[model samples]
Target: MKNNENSDIHLVINIAQQTLILYQHNKKMAQYAVSTAKNGIGSQQDSGCTPLGKHFIAKKIGASEPINTVFIGRVPTGEIYEAKLGMLHPERDWILSRILWLGGVEEGLNKGSNSEGGCDTYQRYIYIHGTPDSEPMGEPLSHGCIRMRNEDIIKLFDQVEAGTSVVIIAH
Candidate 1:
């Protein structure tokens, strides 16, 4: 992405507050409640935790998909999420609406592995995405990704593009 593409807007996810704040030109534009990893924060593969540090939106998906549209492997599953469907598949980790696929920028912390124990955020498929309405927000409940409400995700997706900067902070 060009350097100017995301110079005006950025995102900050505060794990402690369980909130995602959107900033444009260094001013707060919006804030939304979010759910981080239930397992807490880590950068190792399969750790089921949210990785910290600097990241950028590597991909923007589901541009025109309807809210509650299900996604598997970042591909639309053609299934709209609802109460009945969620009940039918109790074990499914629902990735709904849009996806802001994140790629770490700080090497060894989140971008790439290093001697001190690190992993790739993109490789781990870490994303800021939609979750079912039934799920709780402002809490640590997701497997790893930052989970937002379906409507909130859609709103965010429309406002940002690939290459937008994001920062995840433990405090």
Candidate 2:
């Protein structure tokens, strides 16, 4: 990751290309392949799908935890991720490494339009987090949150903080 004197990092996620771009201020720093929701994209509360449009890192979790540690609901489970262990829990969502919790910036689309009903975006609990090593990285495979490799997630976790601007653009 490239360091800049800028106060915030700009993040762009492309679902079609399965890539995440990190920019310090306006300068490109790093780009890594990612896996998004298997159900495709949309910005809806309780959709169990990836949201598009503008979002922000509402919360940051797992700061000093070791890589490949298992996390459930953004809290480390104290069990390290292992291939055999993963095979045991074949159905686990498997949030590993770090978590960058995302909350929708667009009120209507994500937070719910007044025409629809009042819904809380933050309660939806969308995030960009790490997945098990056995999982495919450059494909759409998550329930909703974006999934990245352990190393990539850790690197990204260090570069950005809570409230960092994250833009999800569909191709």
Candidate 3:
């Protein structure tokens, strides 16, 4: 992405508050309640926990799709998420609305490592995406990804572009 592409907007996810703040030109544009990982905060593969520190929107998916559109591996499945679909697959980790695939900015902290303590968040496939309406927000309930409501994620996806800076803070 060009340097100017995301210069005007950025995102900050506060784990403690379970909220994501959108900033444009360094001013708060919007805030949305979110759900983080249920396993808590950590930088480890298979931990099912949210990783901390600075990151960026590595990729943006599901543009032009309707709300509740289902995505698998960032590819639209052509299926819109509804209540019955969720009930049929109760064990599924629904990735709906839009996907803001995240890549870590710091090495050895939240990115880059295939060894004992090197857990790359990008490699972890961590994303900010939408979940079922029946799901609760403002809580730690996801499986490592940051979950948002359908309406909120759609709104956010329209406002931000790829490469936008994203900071996740534990406090």
Best of the candidates, lDDT: 1
lDDT of each: 0.92, 0.82, 0.90
lDDT of 3 by residue, 1-82 (tens): 2223447898999999999999998899999999999999988988999999989888888888998999988899999999
Worst 10 residues of 1 by lDDT: 1-10
lDDT of 2 by residue, 27-126 (tens): 8999999999998886555566788887788888899999998888678889999999988888888899898887776777666554655433466777
* Error in Å for residue 107 of model 1: 0.8
- The best-first sequence of candidates by TM-score reads 1, 3, 2
- Residue 116 miss distance in model 3 (angstroms): 2.4
Candidate 3, lDDT over the whole model: 0.90
